[model samples]
Target chain A: MKNFGGHVLFLDRADINTDEIIPAKYLTEIAREALQPYLLESLTLDGFDPKRDIPGKQVVISRANFGCGSSREHAPWALEVNGIRLVIAESFARIFRQNMFNCGLLVVELPCDTIARLFTDYARGETFATADVARGVIQIRTGTKAEEISFRLSDFDRQLVEAGGWLEYADARY
Target chain B: MGQTVAEKIFETHVVDRPAEDVWVIRLDAVLCHEITTPTAILDLMRLGKDRVFDPSRIKAVIDHVTPAKDSNTATQGKVLREWARRHHITDFFDIGRNGVCHALFPEKGFIRPGYAVIMGDSHTCTDGAFGAFTPGVGTTDLAVGILKGVCAFRRPQTMKITLTGELPQGVFAKDVILSVIGRIGVDGATNRIVEFDGPVVQRMNMEARMTLCNMTVEAGGTCGICYADAITADYLWEHIRGEYPDKAAAAADFRKWWPDPDAVYEKTIVHDVSGLEPVTTFGQKPDNVRPVREMEGTPIDQVFIGSCTNGRMDDLRSAARVLAGRKVHPHVRGIVCPATTKIFSEALEEGLIRVFTDAGFCVTNPTCGPCLGMSTGVLAEGEVCASTSNRNFNDRMGRGGRVHLMSPATAAASAIAGHITNSELYKA
Candidate 1:
């Protein structure tokens, strides 16, 4: 997968579960493409409508336990289809993290302090950023001091995440 | 190091993989329902797979949108029915024969100890109560399993929860599990295999153990396991394999796979619930729970005592005992849905259905109604329901539908009181 970075959409909320990401009603739409417009519709963040606001943002940053409830793969599919390539959160729920990797989305978990700073920088009009998965750092574009925030990924996960997803990795291996 | 039951199961099933490494494991049983099977079928067809690898090992049930609420759900159900029939799947349960997938699968002897079970629904973890490692999967992975008979899984860390002390007379296993959720936050056990043990679990019946394991998904746990014992063997012989002596004899092998005495757990927790009260959820999350007595007089619009979680015969009996001589409140609507046709027939023979019917409850056929907001009893806007199902998330039942999760006894008592009340205050 190609490394990507752009203006990040900051949803300053804690414990945002999968229910907020994709509501139960929309799960009836079996196709992944049909569920895209309804992504995060239930999440009422200020100045952000997921259907309208997601086109320009390449990354989504959220608080701890970002995808917390329900093992619905549609949650990640909705985000991926709606043009979210990477997600940086303080932490992630296990199933959603797995779903993201399975559906070809890059998810990174950074320390809480650095995540808080990213949100603060966004508020202060520091919009541009770069996520270099190969370099293991997220660099700020417009900062007084050059900010290079490092993230963690195990060798096994790096190989899978860098290769697009689990299914592709599995296909390549077999 | 010694391993928990889940670790042991993975050790045996996962091919050439260490702990925490992804390994493709052969799935003993794969279940898909109407709402999910359609997509999985499409994916399978997209992969140019015309037939299921093992039709006998796959179970396709239509329980989510039974009787077809609308044309879309009807089409989906039809697609699944046609696919199952065309593929000659051995265990396909249609609407009349189907119930909630989690409850009916085990009752029909589809689940057994020491097996790797997977289903499209998130509550598939309910089968973990049978000492099997069951995890919920999405349609893609489910489709892959249907074609290949295997799915990739990483060995999860294990947690041991020891339930100490005997349950009080009025308390139930639902109360015990709700209390545990209150201790651990909603996402506290995410991706961890929660192994239930100790004195209380040993004494609980299969139904009670299922109740304990049913809500593990609410804690974001991968699976919840209780090692097979004499009770499990007796359950299989008497309940599951009735009139089939050979299956009962074969089921005796389940007892050999209990956790090692010194099993190494990532975390071990002990909960003492000897004097626990009947618990219920107050807010949106299931873990947002309180004692039913503490939340009395909290207004409710409906009471639903059915789902895979607490819709078994024992759950029905508990509700029946509470609503025997009582009438449902005028303002509240009460619904009693058995988990399966077998449960419905048993409740009918035992006069539990009569008790519910006499109390103004609308006893219905086996369907997962109002739980996922499909149909049959969908709540209206601003409606508050006291339900025995697992979740209480926002808009779970209907648009702006509020749910208070509770045990069957608490739900029955609340139906009578027109509020969230416990069975302890009810008089026979």
Candidate 2:
């Protein structure tokens, strides 16, 4: 498994729906590649595309009980299509977080200080490193402060990460 | 373990055996419309199932792309009719019987609270208003549900949203949900059981509750649920009591499932919904809440009150109450499409038809006649109309028309004033 880590784009808040991630109307007409145009399009008028986001693994920090809404797989599909390696939120919606992990999307939950470092990273481009999974703590190093962010991964997700995506894991599971 | 009303239901409907290891709650009811049914029927055929598991549990309605917009629609409608007949599915809503599935399901009493419901279309979650645990399913799940009566998945965390205080006058349920979306952002309700309670939630009617719960997914809630109460009992009794000879027996089955006071929730959010104004979603999403009273000179060309979201007798009655004596503005097109033929007949009987026609508004036969972009009442380019439908996606109702969603009362008053206004406009 690739133990990846990076800076965070902190959205430390709640209630991100599938429509906001990818509008329903588009589901009928557009292909998955076109989903990049939206991503968080509704979040902002000139929204950032979910695809072609930051290169390589990146951390997205969010606030309490995140990812709640319809069980649309498109949200995580868009996130994974982009380079979002791991999502560190206070919590994740049941279906959304699972959908992400099922599709080999990684999610990590962290405490407030580790979350605060995410804000710092977004502000100052300070990089965070995730090395050891046995220790749930993620190491975030800024110019002034280096703090540890705690995260936990289920066995299923750890297996997905180890096998590198579900298709590979399914090769073994089946 | 303390469980919210939603959690209790999920636990009951757990997929597979009664063992706790089952993650996804198996769905009880499966709903389908024209757009998604075509693929589902094909998949059903591929599975070599000549007959459905249970006709009563599965329903097919032709709301989307119905009314035969073009040559393709004619073919599509015919195909759908033949498919339904071949499958021996009794519940069929032709264009004449057509209305958005969400609106008619509850109006007709198919969507009961605490039941696990799934629909092919996204707005299937709209039924959460009746305290029912409904969510949208995809093509594969639709077919699977028809054959096996269940779909699998992991359990979701439960979040309790306790709304206190009364809504500020003119502030409808639509506004409350929008404000919630605004407060928590889109992913706030994600992967969690959303149980709405507190004084304000209890005060909402079935229509209002539907409006609130319908958008549970919009707030990122897994499936929205309201505690089944007297309101739910009254609605069921009034609508389906006659059909169920043993009314008490039918009602008894639902009571045991509702979440008790000691229910567990990941988080409890309290919103003081005292002074919020009625909101209109001018843009694509339902969270686009703007007070109709202050449209700020945004001229509206039409007002629509229908669809799965807010097209019911209560919605029509509320709108009619606002427009009883007031005439619709000459510049605006006031259109009302009841969610079902039953609602249409009832409204016509109750003098709502007179109110609409006299006020220069029009009421059409039940169908997904307008919303979903397959409407005879297509809006002109750049024209804006306040709607009561579930979604306001691009060209959702018509080509180049800008749609804003709101409560039916807001649509009615706005229609009378030629702009977005509330019932208060009439008194003023």
Candidate 3:
């Protein structure tokens, strides 16, 4: 059973694209660590500031269609380098969702109403979550409130996370 | 239990069932480009798994930041060049020959009906116009496709988009796709394969079909597919002639990839383009669409007419038609990049290049630059561009730059007007 989740960063907008995750200009760089400081650098959510908002957050809560536009693994690499491992959203672009799993990060797709509730209940507070892969539930808490939310990962996705990433899985199988 | 074209292709390519509803499918082609492939190549080397599964099945190109914007970009191109050579991949297209990968690969006739293709760039879905199961992947899956020739996916449900009625005189495939995206919203088709069908799609040539499928990703579609028809056969006849006796035979053979009449779709939507007008993106997202009429007179600093989406010969000809005698507005800078070296040569011979140059548009060699803001015509802060390329995401063209997506004709017209405007006013 692997552990997931941490401090939550709530991005309230939909269609948070790859360009926003890691701008196309930085994509010329070869190293993954080179992407660390630039995570969400171009995101233009109402009051979000990458320099102020991304430092210690280890999880992302966002609206629908997160990670849309341009299929770049650098998007996930940016998140990973920033020490974020879990993303909870109403939905995600197809390639971005798979890329997250390939990198051993988790993208939890909650229903629209559920995500709205999560934002209403926790977004303004200092939120933290503890995700249990084995039990398929996430324990979300703030200073004075706590809630349990369940998530399901496909068997292959769970295997990828347990193996650490696609590279490790390929090492064993291929 | 009839199957869609995507389902049939997946069935044919399946190598294993990794999990329930998850099938590991063998890839027929793995498309690679400088911007994304270098990281995959480096990772494979670090893991001591640098060998490709099949050298011949790989197609490599140096399209993004071509001629290299700086040493870092030069290194990225060099990495892909050396990797292709080391793997004995003969289909590598270097600086003088390279173009945008999505346009270049299909131009070489590498894609065919029923093929399963993957690339590291999102616009790779443009290849699905050939009636293939082509989808974009990330670097990790790209590395796996390169190394083992296999990638996994959950079975994608199909969403059928039936395009009815006729395309209006000034409305092109770019407008049609933009309209579709607007109707569906950005994530309307998430995790689904969109199968484009009906009379309008049937009438479109391969270039138009590619434009329709190219932006499917903007609507969150994994792949946008079209059924192979006589037009597809005619376009592919040069490369596929050896397999079939004649164009008719080739068309018939390719038709095997079409979905069965009883095939099920998760949902169906229809669009009638009889009164369709030129459209453009108003905001950062691709789905933030508006008719060119409403967005007209919105000032623009640049007009870019290129990218895999609309950089074909027809696109250039359309743009040239608008710019034939009119000079670009003094306040605006215009750039035109043909999609491929072949298209560039043809456009030169057709005098389209002269038309563009006469109009004060900087005619450049084929590169995906400026489309993603790497080079060629990057925008400065507070700048707005009327662009023919897809994806209007904020800062996509440059930091603090705004990109409004439209057709090449509209882009050219905007260059003349110095604002976001329709091409109808310029049409002969």
Candidate 4:
């Protein structure tokens, strides 16, 4: 997995659906790789920018039960294929989050301070350093001002986070 | 603190041992329909799989194509028919005996109280009417279940949905579910245990219970369950009376299939159905509801009479009753598609179909034809229709075919009225 030891970004309080991520008609076809373009179509209405870059400072922080309904695997597929760093929500749905883990995507839950730091740096495209996955503390350095964000990953999930996905972990296991 | 028998039965299935936060459980039954069955079976063949874990544990029925007119659906049906014969998979399939999978399962006793079941169709929540932990799964999940004999499940936060008092005249189970959908919008009950309670629920039959639980997918819940009682046991025993010797013994154990009175629930919702009428949803959402008495003169062009959600004997009979003597309006095109071949023949025997054909309505064979725009009945652009199927999201029935989801009775009334009208208007 590509390492982003000290980068952070944020998306606050948006509950996304698969229809918004990828419409129903698109699911009629068997091919899944072309799903990255339709993200937030139901919410954004017009469309989402496809050229948005995310090699670093990438994460989505949102409110409860993100990716709640519809067992469509495209929601996680679009996010993973488009290079989203991590989805740090208040919670996640069972099937959708599992799909994310299967595809080797990271979903982190961070304290409010860390969320704000991640949010600001991501929105402004300015660099914010949040390099503390161990010791349960996140340090976000936004230029001169630095904020400490709290976070933790369970041992089982840490392997997913480290290996970049469950399929990778399972592949390595075999 | 008043728990229904359905809640009690589920508690018995709860397997909360060490390190497991109740994420999965063993299944009592498994169901698959034609659309996904081809692939599920194909996957098994690809893996060189032979003989499922349990033949009696599985059931396959043709649903998507009944009035198999074209060579394609007929061929698809033939492939599945051969699979059933070779495997002896509790064959319930019939062109004549067929109905929508979700609607027929409980009618056939494939779903019952405390049963842990999984189905490939999204509408598997329909079985929850029998007080079972029934939910829909994708082909991958079903194939996985087909291979391993089990699948994972996350125990949901319990929701106590109490229906108070009696329903007003003409307001059936469809109205009750649509009312709940209206209150909760679409996503209100996601990942929660929706237990139907109160006096209205108590008085309801298993079919009515099935209707309420059938569309739980619209509200996005794990599944909806009614407490299994003497009523449930009696229905189950009576349906499979001649077939099984242990049927009586199973029915006698109703008390074994319910929740304890002191069961814990994550949330509770109460519905007072004191005054409601035949309701219908316009626009692109199922929760978009209005009383049938209210939809007078709302211009409609098409009326779809089929789908897994409302395709059954009773649903057809109810619609036929409303359309008996009346002629379908000149402007309104009434498209009637049966859920299965049995319902088609039964309707023909009853002369209910003659009533439809004489009234200038189009009677189609058993298929999801117009309902899903798969084949048969296709809708035109900018045309508004009153449909009996679930989900009116965008143009699901056809391209730009504005679908207004309603009960069969309501659709019948709308067909006669030349607009979205109440079935009560045509009665008597």
Predicted structure with the largest lDDT when compared to the true one: 3
lDDT for each candidate structure = 0.81, 0.67, 0.92, 0.67
lDDT of 1 by residue, A33-138 (tens): 9987787876746677776666677778888878876778888888877777778898887778877776656788988998898777664554666778778888
Task: Encode model 2's per-residue lDDT on B1-428: one tens digit a residue.
Answer: 66666667767887443223334556667787766556556545654654566777777777755566665556556656787788687887786676677776776678876778887665676777676777775554565666667754445577878898888766678778877876775567765667788899787888788878777776656667777776777778866666656556655655776676676678889987887877777666556666665564567898888876777788888888898988888898888887777888899999998998888888877766566555646777688877877666555555567887777878888888777766776653
Residues A100-172 of candidate 3 have per-residue lDDT tens digits of 9898888888899999999999999999987788888989999899989988888998998888787778767
lDDT of 4 by residue, B364-405 (tens): 767665666556666777888888887776556556677788
Tens digits of per-residue lDDT for model 1, B1-428: 77678777877887544124776788899898887678768766775665687989999888877777777788888888898889888699887788889889988878888989888777888888889999887766676677767777776788989999989877998899888988897877887889999999999999999999988878878878988876777767645455446654645667656787888888999999877888888877778989887888999999999998999999999999999989999999999999998999999999999999999999988988678777777889899999999888777788788998889998999999999987977857
lDDT of 2 by residue, A118-140 (tens): 66565455456553565666776
* Candidate 4 wrong stretches, greater than 4 Å: A1-44, A47-174, B1-18, B37-51, B65-97, B242-252, B292-295
Winner of 1 and 3 under DockQ:
3
Candidate 3: list runs displaced more than 4 Å: A1-3
- Restricted to chain B, the TM-score per model reads 0.96, 0.90, 0.99, 0.89
Sorted on TM-score, best first, the list reads 3, 1, 4, 2
Best of the two (1, 4) by DockQ: 1
Pick the TM-score winner: 3
TM for every model, in the order presented, reads: 0.94, 0.73, 0.99, 0.78
lDDT of 3 by residue, B78-140 (tens): 999999889899999998888888889999999999999999998888899999999999999
| Best-to-worst ranking by DockQ | 3, 1, 4, 2
